[model samples]
Structures are given as structure tokens and as C-alpha cells.
Target: MEHPLGVQPQMGLFEGGADVAAAMRTRGLGALACLPDEALLNIMHELAPADLARLACSSRALWAFANHDELWKGFCLDQLEGRWDFQGCWQDTYLLGKQAKGFQPGSRKMRRAAGLQSDLLYTPWLCATCAIDPSWLEVENVDRRSGLSVAEFREQYEIPNKPVILTDVVTKWPAMKKWSRPYLKKAFKGGMTPACLPNCVVRRFDKTFCETAPQLAKDYTVPEVFSDDLFKLLCEARPDWRWLIAGPYKSGSGWHKDPNSTSAWNGVVSGRKKWILYPPHITPPGVRPSCDGADVASPVSIMEWFMSFYEHKASTRCESVGYTPAECILKEGEIMFVPRNWWHIVLNLDECVAVTQNFVSEVTLPHVLSHLRSRSPALVSGCAKEARSGLYDRFVKALKEHRPELLERVAAEEAAKKKRAQEQHKLAGLFKGPEDACPGVNLANGSSAANGSSANGASKPEASGSAAAAQNGTSAGGGFSFGFKL
Candidate 1:
């Protein structure tokens, strides 16, 4: 059946085998019940499998809430690694698997959900199926172009830090003709790489993996406009930048900026993608970044945001802010350039296949460096142990050794920024009522925004191993951990 968004969800196993969304309306668990699915997931995320199983036995209603397959998928990913071959669903698969910790697979009897049909239960099922409202798309489109040279692209979009849809670019990619579900499945049939299904793995599209999966990597090349990624100076130490993305209609991330203050290019190889983007300055409705910016809170699913906030709330925000979002329905073989720190969400119009790569270039080199230097190691994505701590130093050292010219430019830019900040501070001080405190650092001057931007603006990307990995937080705009959706 068609959903309000005009697409039907491909039927699959265990789609509505949860009571989470129904609880959103009924307060089935009293104060703890009927919250948004993300709130429920957050609470469940802290519970162990044993605890969840215990909750299942509390009552028939909580049984439905606790037995969610998505929860178990997360538990499986957290406790184990590699392929998940489900024996009915993730819960049955993990508990029955040898790696199961506290419970045997299928050890506990699940209460049969018999008379639980309602619009409320359908709420969870609709989240399982299709639910996006077509009316959510009341916004303007980004700029579009064809046959633009690299210099023109930089002048019009990159340097100005604006998003644009490259109308004709992806038509040249071999992926537009070659990639699809059966073909991708067959390409990795030899299993040189463990093919991922439900819980996807972030394939590092580096040299070795490219040589092994030449068929996949050779399908597309980075468009020249964004090929100047200065992060290449860090060599292999660079974060996870490219991803192989696929999902059903409505399966995508919450609103977020790219991590490490990098810009991006996303090209669809198959199916259409719907995109809504807010500029670096405009945070989308229902999205909140923590004070430290180490965490970003957003609606649990793409559909929820569009349904709950896209109309009046978004319009009111836009009217108050005097700006609107840049939006589009990206068709097959069409690519998008997402500028640095732009808040964006990509929803699939159907089963879609795509590749997105994050990058840093002259336009954003200074901002990227500042972020790496200031943020806590825990908030950074795609580094391990010592590499994480020394990332900023390593990038700088590499830039100084090789791209000395770029480093010099970055230094000049930083100096100019400080000068601007100091001027703004001095101007503000003219209006200052004598509280006799104007330090050289300008901390007491109260107009520090002129001097420089902070790294706290970037979203903390949840890397591999959680079921909700891709739910709200994003890294490079897509990725997840142990059954977590990235």
C-alpha cells in the first residue's frame, strides 16, 4: 500500500514487532511510556539484555516494548562482530548464537501480540512501513548547474559556502549503470569483504580495499570541484570519509552537520533521494546541539521531524529567522555539494544506493584545523588510541611538511580573523559602561564571536556498534555501530 509520502515500504521480517511507537501516544508505561521512539531507545540503550528480558515479563504491554528487534540488534552488535544471520530476527539470532552472554536464544517465551490492532499500534508499524508526509516539502531548492568548470564551482558555491545540485555530473559515472541490489550482492559473493545487510558496515574506500573491490570503487570518481580535499595530507590517518549507503524509503539520518567541519559530495547511483539543508547558521527545527556541541539531539527518524515540525514550527522558525532551507529530490545520477557545517538530512524516496565523501579544501581549511585542535578526543570520529589524540598535530605536521603554501594561507586567515575579532571587541568596548576589565585576550570584552568560530558546532558522529548509530547523531552524515543505523 502507498503511504502518504507516495512510496510503499518493502515488506520485510519483524517490521512492527515492537510497541515503542504505540507507547508514544498511550503512556503505556505511565511517565516512561509514549515518549518519542528515540527517548525510549535512549532508555533501552542503557539496559542490558537480561534487564530487557525481565521488563518483558513485567506485563504484556511492556513485553512488546522490551521485545523490540532493533534493541536486540544493538545488543548483538555491541557484544559480537561480523555477519548477522538472523534466525527469524536479531533477538532470536543473538540469543541463540554462541556469543550470547546472559540469555540463550529463544530461552524466554514471548507474549503473542493478538488483539493489539489500533492506529496506535499502527504508529509503530507505520514507522516500520511508510509514514512521511508529502506536504513536508514546502521549501525552496538550492542552485543547480551543468558544465561548470572547477573554478566556477568554487566561486559560486564552494568559496561562498553554499549548497548546489550538480545536475549533470553523475551522468558520467559508471555506477549509474552498473549498481543495484542483485549486482552488488553478486559482486561481493566471493566474500572477500563480508557483505552487510541489515546492520551495515562502513567500508573504508582506501587503496587496498579498492584493489580488492575494484568493481565497486571503479564505478565512480570524485568530482573535480571537491577533489582538492586537503585532508589527504594526513594520508591514512584521515577519518572515515566515504560511505556506501542503501536503505528503504524514509530510512535516513536526523538533521546534522558533517563532522570535523568538512564539506561533502553525495551522488546517488540508484533510486531518488530527498534532501533538506539549513545553512551553517540555521539549526533546523527540533534539532538541538549540546552546549559543548559534543552531542546533538534530533528527532529519532526522518519521518517524525517532517511530520511533527516541518509545517508550522519550521515555517515559524524560517519566518522569524528570515531564511528558508535548500531542498531537493535528488534523482539517480544527480549529485549534491553540501557546504561545511550545513545542517542536512537525506531521505530515500525508494530503495536507494549512493556514495558520499566528506572533504576539506581551501574554503574550509582553517575551520577544520580549529575543530581538530579544540574538540575532545571522545567526540572525534574514525580514529583509534594514540592517533585520535595527535590528530590535529599530525595534520598540521603533514601540512607543514608538504603543503606549506596551504599552511601559510591558513595562518594568514587565522591572523585576519583575530584582527576582525579584536576590532569588533574594541567597538563593543566603546559602548561599555565602566566595569574596568578589558583583557588582552578579549574574554571580558564580550564580543568574541568576531575573532573565530569554535569546533563545538560539529555533530558527534556515532561510529559502528549501536543499533541507533545512525538514528539521530551522524558522522560524515552516515554510519552506525552494532545494529545501529548510520
Candidate 2:
């Protein structure tokens, strides 16, 4: 007989009463049914879903316990990382999960799912990618007890441009409880347009919900550490920069930096995401950037990129200190800080919903302003005009009102930068002509003579401490810095 859910029917535990009695007597134990209901339920809870279902067919006594909604509810909650509560019958949710996992590779229904190119459970790529673990992905975790104050965050992580997973930052967010699948589906009802990544290695569903949906703005607040979001103040011009990211299970984004050079923070409201990060200081060898800094040409997909770059070269390139990319999994209610110029790739472990924002703090504001002034003067000029003020004065005023000490820090840094520039200009005049330029001078120290041309007739990289500053805002061009992404 066919089972309704296609589940294998359970085997009979005691088809013959005499045999059951004989077995019990041989073991010198009473009948299993004689156990109390609480004990039976506890035992049933420990069984896997398949085994529990099989036990239901053994006898009428086990059938009642197996069908209990509480039993299945617990299973669903545990598997979902305790983020979702069953909205209706727990059996229905369990059956849905089971059916989702049951889809055969290349099945018609699986192929038709929007943005779902592969199943999380059945994909050969997922299995292979998760199998190989590399050592360089040693992600640093900073929790509440780490004493991660704003000053320390800037000095330790932000200024150095390193990735760190912040564990306790988003625990009190209103979105943690309010942003559910049902609520989001309703908010985005009639498919009120989302920015879809076209022909991307992984399907990414992005919608600029922060501007379109007023309700979301109320639900999601900026993290305290990144409260100085100058972009939000100027969002009227570049509305496309901010967005809400939602993708189905097995859907995610490819290798890319956050648009513009601004630093970003992504808070997962629910579900899980696997992040692969490459710091700006040490990128994988032979990574070719596309003309548009937004994308890259890779072997196949993001996962394949990792496999080919790290897994295949583990013996050589990966053995170097601080060479491995920072890899970590961000679960429900966790927020990740992605510093400017640091490249990252995201893959959803489940159907995921997250809120991400690009912001400029005092640590990064000078860089953002400098990038904007040079790269897109019109944009910077327009923002200042819109505020009915001068660009520098308005920014300074905003800083004074929100963070007075931060303003002082920016002023000090800018003064130091100007002095360095003047010194470099003075030194560059001393070394004129091809003869002086060709032999690369040791500019490792802060000297303009050290900026001599290389053997290939290209100018040697200067120790311009302001390079990071010049490319610190969200990008407005094909390449982020010097025709390269980051």
C-alpha cells in the first residue's frame, strides 16, 4: 500500500503476542507499554524523525505520541536555528521540510523555484564545498566581553580594515522578533520589485526596501557602533546604494565589494549565511577584476572560486601566515562588519532575510569625503547644496552634534595627511628625468625619491597613507581604486 507522505510504513513490533511475551520474559523485563506516558514521550523525543515515524506503526500506544504537534514543533525549531515558530500545525511544517529535501536533482519543481538553482541538502557542490576546510579562514570572534568599545573597534579592526564577527551587537534589535517570513512576504506583496542580479554566479534577490518600505525603517535601526551613517543623510541622491537582501535557500551573492568604498554591516534577522572574506591587504593570487568593479570573472561559481584558490593551493599559498580568507557562518540575530575594500562572498544556508547598511563613521568619514570629492565632485557638491550648506562645514556640524570627539579626530588626521602630501610633493621635484625614475628608489620610508619608476616604466607604489582615504566611499565608477575592485 502507498503511504500518503511517501514515508516508509513502520514495521510491526509485536505481530504475535506469544512471541512478544517470550521476548519480554527472556529479557526479564515488563512490556514496553507498561512504561509511564511521560517516560514514553521522553524516549520518543530522542528518536530521529524517521525512526519516530516508524515507531508509530508499531502499536496504537506509540502512534499518539508520534502524532503530537509538540514533538514535531521541537524538531522544526531546532533545525531552523530556533528562529521560527510553527505558524500552524507542526506536522505540516515538518512534512514541508521533508518534501523540500526530497526533491531529486534537476527535477521540474526544483528547477522552477524562483532563485533556487540547487537544494541545500542534495547539491553535490554544497557537499564538496563544505567538506574541505582550510586553516586560513580563522575568523576572529568579538563578543560582549571582548570590551569592543567604539574607540577599540576603530583602532583594532576598522582602521586596519579587517573582518570581525560581532556576536552580541544585534541581540536587542526590534527586527529580530518582528521580521518573519510572513511579514516580509506581505510587505513585498504583489512583488513590488527587487533588484535582481542578472546572470550572476548565484541568484541574489535585492530590494531597496529602506526607501520604498517605510515600515522597515521603523523596525530596523542602525547599530550603535555604526550610527554615523552619512550616506543616509545623502541617500536622496544615491537611492540604489542601500537595500534589503532576501534570497531563497542555496541562493547568494558572488565575490564583490560593497558598492562605493564605504564600510558596511549586515544583520541577519533570520536564517543562516556562510561568508567568505578576503582582506584588502592580502587577496588571492591571479584574481582578475571586471571592468565594472561590481563583478569578477571566475572559474564557475563563488564556491568553485574558493575550491580552486584555497583548496587546490593549500600546500603553498595558503601555508603563509594571514593568507587564508576569513570564513564564518552568520546565524540568526548576528551582525557582521565588513570594512571598506575587504572583498566578501555570501551564500545562504537557508531561506534568508537580512538588513544591511553602508555607513561612514569618523574612522572612515574622511576617506569617504575624500573619495567623493575626487571621484564624483558633482555628487558631493549636490549633497552640500541640498543641505543648504557647504560640504565640509555641514559634515563638520553633523559630526559636532552627533559626536564631538569624532570631529576632533577627523581634524587631526586631515592635518597629518596634508603635511605628508606637502612633504611628498617637495621630494618628487628632487628626482626628475627617466634616469632618476627608472631605478626604483626605496620609498618604503616617507620620501618622494622613493617613488621612482619601476623597471617596467611604471611608477612605484608610494607610501601614500591617504590611498585608503581616497577610496573610502561607496563607488560611483567602473573600478573602485586604480581600475581594480578595492
TM values, all candidates: 0.69, 0.54
The residue ranges of model 2 lying beyond 4 angstroms of the native Cα positions read 1-147, 190-204, 211-213, 238-241, 290-295, 312-322, 374-418, 421-449, 461-486
Candidate 1 overall lDDT versus native: 0.64
lDDT tens digits by residue: candidate 1, 1-486: 432222122222355634443442254466665465457667877898888878777655566657666788777666655355556566777676545566665575656443233333334445555556676555547777898898898776776667888878789998787775566666666453333321232222332334445678888899988799888877777887887776656677678788888899988777787888876545577888776566888766677677667774445222224345678888888899988777898777676667889998876776677778864686566677556767888889988898898777767666776677688778855654555343222344343232333234333222221213222232222221011110
- Model 1 scores worst on lDDT over the 10 consecutive residues at 477-486
Model 2: lDDT to the true structure: 0.54
Models, CA RMSD each = 11.0, 17.9
Per-residue CA lDDT of model 2 for 85-170, tens digit only, reads: 23344555666655656633333221111111112111223433253344524453432223377776776666666666676766
Worst 10 residues of 2 by lDDT: 109-118
On TM-score, the candidate that comes out on top is 1
Q: What's model 2's lDDT at 477?
A: 21
Best by lDDT: 1
Give the runs in model 1 whose Cα sits over 4 Å from its true position.
Answer: 1-58, 75-124, 138-140, 190-212, 313-322, 420-486
